[model samples]
Target chain A: MFFQILDILGTIAFAISGVLIALNKKMDPFGVLIIAFVTAVGGGSLRDVLIGIQPVSWMTNMTYVYVIFGATVFAVLFRNKLNYLRKSLFLFDTIGIGLYTVVGIEKGIVADLHPIICISLGTMTACFGGVIRDILCNEIPVIFRKEIYATACILGGLTYFLLREFMSDTNFVFVIAGIIVIVVRLLAVKFRISLPSLYKDKP
Target chain B: MFFQILDILGTIAFAISGVLIALNKKMDPFGVLIIAFVTAVGGGSLRDVLIGIQPVSWMTNMTYVYVIFGATVFAVLFRNKLNYLRKSLFLFDTIGIGLYTVVGIEKGIVADLHPIICISLGTMTACFGGVIRDILCNEIPVIFRKEIYATACILGGLTYFLLREFMSDTNFVFVIAGIIVIVVRLLAVKFRISLPSLYKDKP
Candidate 1:
């Protein structure tokens, strides 16, 4: 029940973020909805596809679609009122990633994938939606540019595996791992932490 | 026998295109190979995933990896000479899209999808590899811009269904549909045709 609530909250937060970006880009209504849908479900869709799951998670579950639609509509109707909620939006986004990372890692484990691959799946699940949104909006993905976003997910995945060796209680492991992701991400943003660029110019 | 040759040729063409872009971006060797791999199989991977196919096409087929590796090595070593073969590259790219579209449509048909969805699948299969490449390279996707690229695939898909009504030979229909896609794409580029941008600024 707790996880389910966190999942819905995360979906709503992600969808709203997508809607805001689409509106800022001056996209049409159809484009706005598409962006919101992709942002809310894109990561899990990619993970499911990679793991060979059929029809994807969203196609099998209609709740995600409805939630995205509602969030998009709400965002568009209350655009003016959203400005003051930046802090809350950030909080939701952080919490969403944290929960999503643990869920992703668990899914990868169920599939019996390698630990590194599981970590990658977790990171992609939490971050690739923003990557897709930025691509569609014709901008460099914010995560790829200079953010500790994916790194936090990676660290969280590692935490989950490490804790698994010590505790057999699944729920306890999940909560602690999720909290680690949230704290790490929040700290990174607070301190302006970033990964170094790999780009290079000609000799 | 004929389709096998076309498939290999298309993979090589797509891999080369990716290598050229990665080189232009001045990415590292690993990055170059990553781009090449994604460009060669990303579209088909996406199509298979959407249709509920597991393990994706590339993971099960090692041939694609080998082809991409060979193409990347050849492209990087012979980068300067490649500039003079722009005409050949263009021809290969056109033929690649044509073949890929037909294959994508066939996959969709086998999966028992609606005709419209099949056409979309075909267009996505033929074009989305480049879209992925552009996104990774941090540029506006060339297709989403003014290019006549995806339009050609859609037309080819339409032609395939239309030809199927009159012809009983599956191979004949495939050949004709592929040719239509190739000719349309070639003519569009030859005449500098483009779709108008939907963007509109406030007065």
Candidate 2:
């Protein structure tokens, strides 16, 4: 039940983020919708494809489509008012990534993939939507720019497996792992922590 | 025998294109290899996923991996000399997209999707590798701009269905359609034809 709510909320939050970017880019309405939809589901679709899941989760379920559509309308209509709720939206976006990481890890477990692959899947799911959004907006992906976003998901994925050894209940591990992701992301932002740039000076 | 040869040549051409872009971006060796691999197989993988084919085509076959690796090494080693062979490489790349459009349409037909959807799938397969390459290199996708590249693929896809009505042999349809794609693309480039920009100045 908790997971279900989180999933819908995440979809909405991500869609709104995409809409904001599209507006900033002065994209047409069709472009805005496309960006919003891709931002909401691109990561999950990529994960499904990588893990050999056919038809993908979203195509089978139409709720996400409706959520994205509604969120797109809401964001586009209230673009000017969005500044007032920026902080709240950011919180929801952070929470969405935390939940998304756990869900992606669970999907990887179901596929019986390796632990490292599972963690990578988790990070991809939690972050690739933003990557797609950035790509569509013609910017380098923030995740590739030393942001702590994907790293938080990786940490959460590791925490899930570590807790699995002592905890028999899956829900407990899921909740704790999600909390870990949220905490890591919050702390990283608070401390302005980031990865080092890979580019080096030629001379 | 024919199809296999086309596929390998296409892979080599796409990988080399990726290598050229990566070198231009001054990306490191690892980044160069990654871009090459993604450019060679990204389009087909996307088509497979959208049509519900699991694990994507490249993940199951190691041949693509080998081909991309070889192509990347060749391109990197001969970077300075590549200028001489640019025209030859362009021909191969054009042929690659021609074959790719037909392959993508066949996959869509096998899935029993709508004809329009199949055409879309065909165009996507022929163009999305470059889109992924541009995204990874941090730029607006060339296909989305004034390029006539995707339009040629769309025309090829339409030609496939048009030929299918009277043709009993699938291979004939495939070959004719592929040829149409190649011819259209070659002519467009030769004549310097391109789509007009959608963005316009406010009156």
Candidate 3:
């Protein structure tokens, strides 16, 4: 029940973020809605597909579709007021990634994948929605160029495996790992930490 | 047996195209190989996932991986000669889309999806490899902006259903539909046909 609530909140946060980006790009209403939908579900959908899950999670559950739709409409209606809520939105977004990363790791473990692959899946689940959004918007994925986004997920995934060696309580492990992801991202952003540039000089 | 051969050819074509684009972007060899791999299998992987096919075709079959790897190496080695082979490359790409679109439609039919959804699956399978490639390279998908690419796939998918109504031979229907996609693309390129711009003024 707690995870479900977090999932919904994550969906709302992702949908609103998508709305902000789409509106900034001057997309029409339909485009904005589509972007919001993809951003909310794209990462999880990708994870489900990779592991051979049928129909995907969102298709089986109507809650995500409704949440994304409601969030899109709400964000669009009060887009101007959103500037004031940036910090709140950022917090929600960070929490969303933390939850998503752990969720993905759990799914991978259930599928019996290797630990390395699980870590990759966790990072992908937390990051690929924004990647898809950036691709649609004709920009490089921000995670690929800057930000400690995927790195935090990777670290959290490592923490999950490392903590599991000594802990029998899976739920406790999940919470700690998720908290690690959230805390790492928060610290990274607060300190303005970013990935080092790949290029010798900016192209 | 025939479809297998065609699939390999398509993989090769897609991989080579990916290498070309990655080279143009001055990406490292590792990046180029990753792009080629995605461009070769990304579309079909997407289609399989949507329809709930387990392990996806590529994961179960190593043929695609080998073909893409070989194609990438061959394209990189003969980069200079690729210009002379542009027409040949274009032909292969057209054939690749033709095969991919039909393959996707067949998968959708097996899954008992609606005809409209099947058509969409076909278009996605035929075009999303390039979409992913473009995304990884940080550009708008060429198909979304211009090109009669997905249009050809959609028309071919329609042809598949339409022909199935009158024909008892499934192989014949596949051939005709694939030909339609190939022919439409060939004509579009020859005539420089494109989707009309959605924007009233250039942004």
Per residue, candidate 3 scores C-alpha lDDT tens digits across A1-203 of: 98899878878998999999999999999999999988888898888888887688899999999899999999999999999999989988998999999989988898877776677678778888987898888876666555678889989999999999999998999999999999999999999986554345653
Per-residue lDDT tens digits for candidate 1, residues A1-203, read: 87888888889899999999887876655556667877888898889887977667775566777788898989988888998888888888888899878878888989999988988888888999998888788877888767798899999889988888999997898899889999999999999887765667521
Give the alpha carbon lDDT tens digit for every residue of B60-94 in model 3: 56577678888988998888899998988889899
DockQ each candidate and list the results.
Answer: 0.17, 0.17, 0.19
Considering just chain B, what TM-score does every model have? 0.95, 0.95, 0.95
Clashes of each: 0, 0, 0
Highest DockQ: give the candidate number: 3
TM, every model: 0.61, 0.61, 0.62
Backbone clash pairs for candidate 1 read none
In model 1, the Cα lDDT at residue B23 comes to 95
lDDT of 3 at B153: 96
What lDDT score goes with residue B72 in model 3? 89
Candidate that would win on TM-score: 3
For model 1, residues B1-203, the per-residue Cα lDDT tens digits are 97888888889999999999999999999999999988989899888888787678889989988999999999999999998978888888899999999989998888777676677678878988987898789875666545678888889999999989999997899899999999999999999876543345541
Clashing pairs in 2: none
